[model samples]
Target chain A: MLDHPTRIGRLALVGLGLIGSSIARGARANDLVDTIVAIDRDPAVLERVRTLGLADHVTDDLAAGVAEADLVILCVPVGAVGPVTAALAGALKPGAILSDVGSVKGAVMAAAAPHVPDHAAFVPAHPVAGTEQSGPDAGFATLFQGRWCILTPPEGTPPEAVARVRGFWEGLGSVVETMTAAHHDLVLAITSHVPHLIAYNIVGTAADLETVTQSEVIKFSAGGFRDFTRIAASDPTMWRDVFLNNKEAVLEVLGRFNEDLAALARAIRWDDGDALHALFTRTRAIRRGIVAMGQETAEPDFGRRGAKG
Target chain B: MLDHPTRIGRLALVGLGLIGSSIARGARANDLVDTIVAIDRDPAVLERVRTLGLADHVTDDLAAGVAEADLVILCVPVGAVGPVTAALAGALKPGAILSDVGSVKGAVMAAAAPHVPDHAAFVPAHPVAGTEQSGPDAGFATLFQGRWCILTPPEGTPPEAVARVRGFWEGLGSVVETMTAAHHDLVLAITSHVPHLIAYNIVGTAADLETVTQSEVIKFSAGGFRDFTRIAASDPTMWRDVFLNNKEAVLEVLGRFNEDLAALARAIRWDDGDALHALFTRTRAIRRGIVAMGQETAEPDFGRRGAKG
Candidate 1:
């Protein structure tokens, strides 16, 4: 925003859910784009998007939406990336920059590149911002503020196109960074994917316990398990799709996490308090680092929308 | 406080640390006691007790403080229950009621009851409330509000004594529940101890993952590890004492948790999405149950005492 013009001649959102709607809000609020178009298969969703004024035009036809747009951002789940790309390929304008907001970069590129127009540039992005909530109604214009948006541009993607996509995100108040697709996958595997899986796994584990009742698990979650439940409560469909699409990355990180956790279990089983205490002490520094990084705002409530009460 | 009595004559806190000072604050706020006599070897902590307006007198002599007190509450770490009880046994007043706020009840009662005077009543209590903070400065009067205080009085412990302890807690706005020490230990092993240990374990693992890098872990902690770090940042001395005192119970729950987690890890390794989704979906219902039961406030936070920025 400090450097680029706040005007997008044409914009196309290939999916109209939370991320897409959030982007729509950001673009509109910053005057970053004009004559925006949105596409989703669900007529009801399209109707809601039109009513919400996330885009000037709403359509089920992906091709029609991308035909005259300067940018087409795929906001669907990772698994849908391929099909959406194929559907919108021929209609994408010459020199158009195709981007996405999927959580996994390698998977997104793998799914979308073959379908990308030969003359168009493709920039794959994963913005490190979201709430447990979903749907167009849940989005707000400032959702991306102070959050990281990593762009993974495959080799040979033109710099100009990358700059345009980066500029668009910058206008939305995000700090944009570039990373190789492989590195991005690794970083996210540790930061986002592993954490989500751990949360999901722990909650699942608690649910399966016979001695400790579910009601009890719920009742005293303040001890710590409650945090996992909140993350595990995230939209299942999105997560299901994420795991399926980022299988290699998620599984890879999960393997390391399990190894790390099993070692910890061994320590606790052996009553290795020194090891436990030492590890815990080191982790305290990480929390300080997170507070320093603008990625997480540590106002308690763990950066969720609001306080529990 | 619907059934609570009018006042306390002489209230004695067996330790003047976080829980003790907090109890002192709550008692003072409710005008539950005429005088608060605090017993702590740490003169500095005891000296600051009345700064929080929770204590009227401070002494390093446990026996002297317990003398003339009708209500004596042990606020020492679980491991220290034995020595503290022995030191104060000869000094407790006739017909005095005794209780504790230890996380582990069975162990505390086992260690403390032998030293109890025949004319005095021993009621081991655990208020399911705390913050990561410690010492007198962290004491707050509202710490017990809307929280649970589980009183595990020994069989044949005077009913009148139990009622008085319950009344004291109720006056502080805590909902009092009665359970056997064994049941209390088992429930707490899962609800509080295991979860806290798991959090400490995961945080430790993240801290030691030199290959993954610390800055990366901290920056991306918004994903999940940040929550664990927060929990693990809790008082090291208190947690060390918990693990040492509640050894058997914590180990029992840890075994169950590991078995369940192993099953989940295998399922993830096998890419069994059905199993994962089924468990994930089941867990969400439990969270809803927590919210519905008011165990977890429906607000996004778990009722942590913090403001959202």
Candidate 2:
């Protein structure tokens, strides 16, 4: 028998896509949960979940799928959380914990908190882990290993309920952290949303340039542009929902980014090497900090062979 | 004995930095050159190069280093290329090929072209491969393996000299391609220069944010920001020169990028999910094209285990 703690009786995962399927796989791999009930609005997704044996019971009916589940995780896009949470609000059992794996915590809490019953716990989470791929087949059992899963529980959320959700994420091999919903949204805007927006915008810009053909861009992309494309290639629906739901914080960070870019452009145009060197030196320190903190690989050349595997 | 074509009787690398050291190591590994002479303005770097045995000989004299070399490769910062090229112009032997590994081709060609003796060939080349690390200790023999090495030879330059340089790069395990100086600049402006500027700008912006502490940004950077930091952490002197030398192309691409980003920001503000989704989907296809073209890896989760080694 595998040695593990905090075994969940039944876990209901809504939206059987990347995160949902990964959670299902992880839960099963560690025997973290006894029963996994998968739910998705798309019938084809339900079929795939059943085929993969990802869930003990796969169903289209949200209420029926989650009725017996002790832990219910909403894994839909950020924009869909409000409607989806409302749809299943009547079904969650008393004392059962409810949570989500959405990128924008504020919007998720706003949409789902209204429908969360007084008797049930609602904890919002954002797992800072993923690949460029999406959908049911794109998930694996160890996606969350050594990654962060941040929980943004509401002001009056019960401590015990928060612990349960944290325990569940830990069971799935994540380092758990807690913060406020608004702070989570703000922090993620800088770390994820703005970076993603910049990547998407740059890729679009590169494609539309008349001087350079798309073939050339694709051919020579190994020189840093390809890195942006990987982040830009993330799921359309998911990113769209994230930007729409977190517009406030995204706009704020983007405003700052444009200002900084303009200043750097001026520095370059005026040939101010000192300013450029100082900025580069500061940023290099940040990369070192990230690597030292174990959030990034210390390998050189992007771990060339490792990237191939 | 390793069999490699276009063997160099005497090879001189002008700058014992990352690219310079890597070339020395690669030439030694493949036995592509019989004698390697490494030169650098910094005495410490030359001492380190000598200590590492990366080159058969190390010297601070630019002229003495290249006088006996049949192949002289300038591996200095873009800003230093012109001055260094002029300094060594008299030292290159008749019919010897002079080349550089600078990121910007037009500026390099312009700076070094006027100084090239009629008897020698000046073929500008750029190997689109690197790690964020710098200096002699960070280089390895396999750095250029499977990487693209673009050559932009001036019009009417001897085809034999271009072919010889191409053969040498191939011996080091690089795929070589030839393009006009202007086209190379435009292509790289989109593929490299603009991306580096954006990464540097974003890291600077994140560092200045009062709402989010630097520690928080660094902690949560695994979400996406860390990737930009890697590129931003590249050599400051090299990139500063890249921007100054390639100012027009960089500004043009940066303008387009800003416009596209404004549109994206508007889409988010207006909640235009369709527009956002359409653009995101299109960019996704481009990434697939790059991966299919073998410029990128198809591995999942940033190839976590591979990053370790």
Candidate 3:
């Protein structure tokens, strides 16, 4: 923040959900912008944002929200990016930078870049952090602290605009990294999308079991199923749009996941204890690497017992 | 430990790994036992246990370790339970009670019940808690606090002996529950065994992906894959034996899980957003139920960032 190159005169945040509210709270807390405009399609959400005093202005009209904004960030579900961008294109200030907090960068770029104005710069970013909870009520200012915010700016993007966006995220307490949109989608397919699908699938599977009652599963979840439940409990609308928009990458990685899963099933069926042992041992090193890199906590049982409200 | 029953005169631990060492430490800290004997087949482990002052006596000889002990607990891998129990069957004191800490209940009962002398009692228990760690150095005195310890007593076991074993686990900071050995297998297969298998399979899948490098997966694991990695990194030999010995129940629950996953995949392919949303919402309730039951943490992100060492 000490070496920040520029400040946003007016920042417009569309879709006042968890990500958008956190951005508003962080900007206000740090005084990164002179004025904040919050917009959401749901009138109830706009009312809640106003009651929370999360922005200087709250509105349901998109054009009015972005009329004089120097920076506009769309925080809606991935499937809504095209329509939202098209609606704001006519009202967006010339030379203003437009960005989004979408999980799938390639899909967002493809859907939004066409609607962007010629004078304005469009940068797509994905912040790799969140809890299972969602909505404006679930947001906090420090959600992005010590987390990675990946920016996927398309070709011919202005360097100054990109740096401004990077500085904006850095001011909000995030480390920024730049990568091609295609690479971003591929990496996220492995790290986020497939993992989420598997979690949802497993939870659904456990629920449908005839031999075990659902109450029993909940009572004894500390064994391991509790972790999957946390991941599966994420916002459904956002995740559904993510899978639908990023179909190719998600399906491709899922295919690879299935092949590996089949091999493991075979190992268990044929009593290949050595293969299972070797694979399990190799995975321990990966967990150690994540802990050492500060990506995950080294605390036993995820420090669940010592958590504060 | 106040208002406890008769004190343990001599307690013998058959394996000096995480569970056994933890029992030794817990017993010594609470003054619940007079003499603690630590037994391990590996001389190095025995030497380490002795160096740590984790036991009153440490030895590699099975006969010498269990001599005149009032309580003996087998803490080895499920596959080794039968052999360890047979070896100590003749050495156990006439009135001593024998127990084990194995995930699979029915198999442990079958493997060790035949070796129990008429004068000695055999009980099988499973503590539904653990970190992604193992070995002597990984144990602590309070590992069982706020955790569920299930004791599966076979029919015709003496009621007085069952009460004594129940009191022992309660004294070590666990809430104890008793059920038939057959039912315990089904419950654990759903709660622990199948969950571990799925975690192991998914971690292997991520590791084997061609589109994403292993290092990239580790770097971005905070997205969701990191949670699965913690469960998959558990002791390999112990899990291998779990799936092998509890084959029938694990396979049964696994079949149900596969069917559910296939249905979910179909929903995604057909773009049934409602179905996906409904399932995701239902799973959220299960997670909430777990938090309410005090089995899991309600803290966001498992309170990983604020954990103490």
- Stretches of candidate 2 off by over 4 Å are A1-6, A306-309, B1-5, B306-309
Clashing pairs in 3: none
Query: Compared with the true structure, what per-residue lDDT tens digits does model 3 show for residues B163-243?
Result: 878877877777888987777788888788888887888787777777678878877777888888888889989998988
Pairing residues by index, what is the TM-score of model 2?
0.96
**Model 2 clash pairs?**
A306-B306
DockQ of all candidate complexes: 0.44, 0.64, 0.58
Off by over 4 Å in 3: A1-3, A306-309, B1-3, B306-309
Per residue, candidate 2 scores C-alpha lDDT tens digits across B34-112 of 8999999898998899789998888999999999999999999998899999999999999899999999999888888
What is the DockQ score of candidate 1, to 2 decimals? 0.44
User: In model 2, what lDDT does residue B184 have?
Assistant: 87
**Each model's fraction of native contacts:** 0.37, 0.70, 0.64
Number of the candidate with higher DockQ, 2 or 3: 2
Tens-digit lDDT track for model 1 on B2-40? 234646889999887768888888888788888899888
Writing each residue's lDDT as its tens digit, candidate 3 over A36-131 gives 999998988998998999999999999999999999999999999988999999998888999999998887888899999998999888888788
Output the number of the TM-score-best candidate. Answer: 2
